[model samples]
Target: MTTIADRVRELTVAREPFVHATVVRAQEPTSARPGDAAVVLPDGSIEGFVGGVCAESSVRAAALDTLRDGATLLLRVLPDDTATFPDTPGARVVVNPCHSGGAIEIFLRPVLPAPVLGLAGGTPISVAVATLAEFLDFEVAASGDYAGATAVVVAGLGKGEQDAIRAALDAGVGFVALVASRKRGAALLDELALTDAERARVHTPAGLEIGARSPQEIALSIMAEVVRAIRVDGLASSPGPAAARPQQAVDPVCGMTVLVGPETPHARVDGRDHWFCCAGCHASFTAA
Candidate 1:
């Protein structure tokens, strides 16, 4: 039941914001089909494959755009004759365009209003982090699949689980944690092929390092770190400076800002955009 249609319908019904990447243009001999698409759920799970891993890499960064402006974008992912992302120096060239020949262009369009959550896995310490996150009034989902934004906590180092933790880091899931020896954390991270950004978000031996021992104490320290991130780093997805931007007439359906200007997609019901976010909102706006 996890079809493109189903995800889209769920997103619309739930009033979530999301990004869908599709293979719109393809060269001959490549595996990319016109309709092949990947829907990045607000929860961070992805369905379908426009271009497999390579394409997914591009999609991950592009999805964050929706969180910023609530705008839809069509990305053109071209096969790099030379290895590496445009600006990145270490990336290897990825050319298997879904087993098809030549390069492919993937279109990433966003669907807005996706719910954001800081998902804490079943760590013994998440008890406190979860509690504080809820008290902060964040809309949390039991499964990370429903979150628009996510944070992973991997405290209580066990065994053979670096891959899962690494994947979260690669996805750039806002925040990540590892409660254990910093020496071990550093060694573990060094074993992975990760970017600087990914490495940076990996807070190993997680928590405030406030000499916490038990699950409850550790949870407090971890939650404190998350709170610190919210206050200083602006890491959470909640509306930001845009909320403080001078109030202007907004077209709710299209979400465009209008100030004593021409007609908006939405006429004044009682007001214009009225603090609306995107063009889609402006378009959806029905006066009154």
Candidate 2:
């Protein structure tokens, strides 16, 4: 039997996005208890139980919102009488209309797909950026071949920086940054003579203004901006889908991530190929 932890690992490895919801508090007449958990899928189906159908609906809605915004939420579903829909920072409140007459507090944590972050240089600052990005759950690559990168940071010591930047731009990377001094970055941009639209895609200075002094601090600043580009600014405008999106599928029986391939064991259900990790998984899915 695959445990929930095992399922989570499979999802992370396959880069499939989902939400993990834990019941931290459950009031009287509730079907859930503290520490109860559920995996909420993109389609609002839950693999585990946090509460009854009423509470599950609320969890699914909040989970979808967290996935879309990439934000953690502390959700409170309260009974109707005292439901004021309190406004709090980093928290959200929803009333359970099922009138279960029970209050439940569930913490929803989003497990989003890791975006590829490409670093063009091998400098100390670039290395630091990769380290920090990995810590923040970004798939970091230190090469010019940003074939799977949604964001690219160019800081090569005048070596292959231009080529990297051009390739990222041509590939329609969502965010392209040049990690250079203000003046030098400006001069390089002038030399590139990119179209206004293309230039808009490049972030000169490549980071927030934090008055950073050391390479590590500079890298931190750049990565902060990179996150904003993907989670904040990038979502504000419609973007064309990049070529680097990974193909992923979810196992209906165990909620594990399944890589679609001919060699992998699979079954065609409802006119779609449902891949599985092993023969056991396929059998379990078929039985279900």
Candidate 1: clashing residue pairs, number? 39
Best-fitting candidate, scored by TM-score? 2
The regions of model 1 sitting more than 4 angstroms off are 1-121, 141-147, 157-160, 238-288
Writing each residue's lDDT as its tens digit, candidate 1 over 1-288 gives 588877788876776666777776666555677888878754444677776444554455555555455566665555435222243332222342222235566666777553344454566566665666677655555453422454566644466447557656545567777766879888888888668877787787788978888787887787678778866776754332232122244333332333322321334454633533333444454432
State the TM-score for model 1.
0.43
Top lDDT model: 2
Q: What is the TM-score of each candidate against the true structure?
A: 0.43, 0.63
Q: Candidate 2, residues 47-74: lDDT per residue as tens digits? A: 8778875576567667877887778899
